[model samples]
Target: MIKIAAMGDNVVDCYLSKGTMFPGGNCLNVSVFIRRFGGVSAYIGAIGQDEAGSVIEKALHDENVDLARLRILKGATAYCVIGHRDADRVFVRADLGVSMFSPSSEDIAFLKDFAAVHIGQSSGLDDHVSAAAAQTLLSYDFSTRRDPEHRRTIAPLCFLASISGGDLSHDEALAIAAELRDCGARWVLVTRGSEGAILLGAEGLFEVAASPADLVDTLGAGDTFIARTLFGLIAGETPHALLSAAAVAAAETCRYFGAVGHGAPIKLSGVVPELQTISS
Candidate 1:
């Protein structure tokens, strides 16, 4: 069976103000969503043999995501200190640790079992995996990175590119997606937190209003959206159907303090998904 891959970087998120910690990263969160939505999912990334890394590994294990390609090195694990409120957030500090992340030949060889790959924000990792997974559909989260040269490098590689508009107005969000389209994005998307999301494709722009969520920690909301979008694409769903599912999945993530179904005890309501059983 074809599995989907979410690989690149992950970090142990330290909620300094809240005195809590959790495994969090774009790719990791994407994997979390895949497993919950009943898709065969794989996570490919590097981690150290530290306590924090142990927690991350355990978390992934709990999610039932395949970790055969996970690299455990000998050093401190990547970590980030975050400060967030009921409605906002701030990154206090971060360290990438000793992880040198890039897909190995063995990892690429494993992609034959997968149908799609979601590229996270690691430049080096992207450099390696994008070309290797050439046969698979590729999607990316732009992460509010507006640097022209950087966007140029990543844009062409994406079948769909998601850009964060945070709280931008309708016109503002459209502008961001347009810029990405100009930079060669085949499908451009702008995610606007609780407001909704906007998409720019061959048929022009479409908007998906945010699904209702009792707001919790907003950390993994965007990541969940990326994962949902990937799964929808692999399912051969239309863009309108895909974005609607993505919006629901993302808002569902917001109802809890972390990404859903990574042992979150959150039940997915609304639409029923029909993917394969999650991989162990």
Candidate 2:
């Protein structure tokens, strides 16, 4: 079986307008999506003892994602307050809380058991990327980070590098993918929202148009694409076939309200004093 580990970052996306929250974050979403795609997946991260953390835990548990490495700290769980503007998500506020954490030497050792380990820009584990990559194939999500120096530093360590390029033109996105490829990433994928996605590797460039969807929310579409792409790659799928499958999976995510659909009522009063009074 294709086994993967998603290390770093987890959060509850609080939708203030709807008074609901959903478990999210790039790594977390990737883990869940990998499992949904029939891969053996594990999640490694820290959460707080708060309600949001419980929400995240339950969601992961329900999805059957391995959580043996999950940590429960005494603090608030990471969260981002969101609002909708005509089906588009708008971030209103956020706090990292206890989400940021580094893996122990033992944790790094554990990573070797998986086929690949996925980490993201928001993961706060940049310093350990080299160490982790040494243990297993590494998949890194740049997530709209365009800093040349940052890309150059990390791209070389990745087996597959993913970027969110929804705002960039086709030429711009392709250039970024090539840049990552030149930087030593075995493969590179750039997702361009409605414009679709592009993949580059030893085989050359492959492009696919976005699949149509009944638009609802776009929260986890990119993460879905990344997870599906990773799954397809591990399954030895062709570049064009994987990109097409990933685009379809991403579009399916767009039809939902949350990353993976386990939502609960959000109690703003329990979040933080300042958040309680914020208008939806």
Candidate 3:
């Protein structure tokens, strides 16, 4: 079995229009998705002492994701207030809350036992990337951070790097993928939304069309792709097979309401002032 650790960032996505919230954040979603794929996964991040934190804890526990490294801090949990426009999610407000944290030496020691560690752009662990990569394969989600210099700096340190190119044209996506590969990322996956995805690796470029879905929400689809693809790589699957499977998993995620589907009624009064003021 592939065992991995997801370090950094956790948030509750609040859909104010629908008065519902879901546990999300790239690292958190990846950990949950890995477990759903039958891999052993652990989450390492901080959360607040509020209801939002409780909600996240419950969902992670229910999914059987290891929370041995989870921290319950004394502030509000990180959150993003979302609004929908023709079914696409739009962020209206956001707060980092207690989510920004660096892994300690002991945490890094524990992470070395895993097959890989997954982190994202929002995960405040950029300084620790080199150290962590030295001990285990590191999977990074660059999301929409497409600065060439930034990619050049971090790509060489990542075993597998994923980027969100959904907004870019086919040529643009291919260009960025090639750049990341040239910068030394052993494997690179570029997701282009409806245009499907492209993977660049040792064998060369491989493209796969996006799988069909009912399309309820597109929030966690990319994260699903990243998590599944990473797991398949560790399991020794071919690039074509893994990307194809990942596209299907991503489509499945689109059929749900939240990142991993544990939705709860939004309690504005219990959240931070920024969230509470929005409802009023």
Candidate 4:
């Protein structure tokens, strides 16, 4: 099994389907999907000590995830209030009372056994922790930056990058990809919801289009896509395989109501038909 370690925030996704709470967050969601797809995975992050945190921990256990490293801090969990208009979700975010930050060298050391270390883009700000974790890092942060210092900070650590379209412009995305490469990243992937994904890998630039589907909540689709993409690459699958699997995962996620559901494993056979390959 390919051991994978994910480090980032654990969010209590409150999906307002006539005002209801739901589970979500990048690390937790990705860990769930990675395990479902046969990767040995662990999540290193902090949560709250509230009832919401309890629910999240239980869900992780029920998902058969290893909870040895999940630290529950005394505060309200980080959350997003999601409003659904038709099938799309609009988010109201709150970062208050979440776990305080700490850079864990031990967590970094533990991730060395894993093939890849995935850090949520938000966690990229925790450069010390991310830089200590692994030589090969995949960052899910896609904020288009105008600051050169921020670019310098992120450039050295990430090997591969995943960003949403809303996070960058076409030209800006290309520039960001190049900047990340200059900073040390080997590949950069920009995700455009419904349109597809753009990749800057070893061979060069390529675009992978999204599979057609009835859109639901696009909550954790990016996280799910990134997890599966890494899984395929770890499995020795080709770029086509990685892109296909990622697309399928994203599509499956959009069929659900929250980020947690995006991690459901779809068979390789199930994704092949809906995928489209692009030129490098």
Per-model TM values vs. the true structure? 0.86, 0.98, 0.97, 0.84
What are the runs in model 4 whose C-alpha is more than 4 Å off? 134-140, 143-148, 167-171, 262-280
lDDT of 2 by residue, 1-280 (tens): 9999999998888887777889999999999999999999999999998888999999999999999899999999998887777777778898899999989998899899999999999999999999999999999999988999999999999999999998999999989999999999999999999999999999999999999999899999999999999999988999988998999999999998998889999876675445786787
Candidate 2 is scored at a TM of 0.98
lDDT by candidate, in order shown: 0.73, 0.92, 0.91, 0.67
- The positional error of residue 213 in candidate 1, measured at the CA in angstroms, is 1.7
Q: Summarize candidate 1's per-residue lDDT along 109-212 as a digit string, tens digits.
A: 77777887777664347566457547566778777777777778877777778887886788877877887788777788788887888878777787899998
RMSD of 1: 8.8
RMSD of each: 8.8, 0.9, 1.1, 9.8
| Candidate 1 global lDDT | 0.73
Candidate 3 lDDT over residue span 44-67, tens digit each: 999999999999999999999999
User: Which lDDT value does model 1 have at 4?
Assistant: 87
What candidate 3 gets wrong by more than 4 Å, as runs, is none
- Name the weakest run of 10 consecutive residues (lDDT summed) in model 2: 268-277
Using lDDT as the measure, the top candidate is 2
The TM-score-based order of candidates, best leading, equals 2, 3, 1, 4
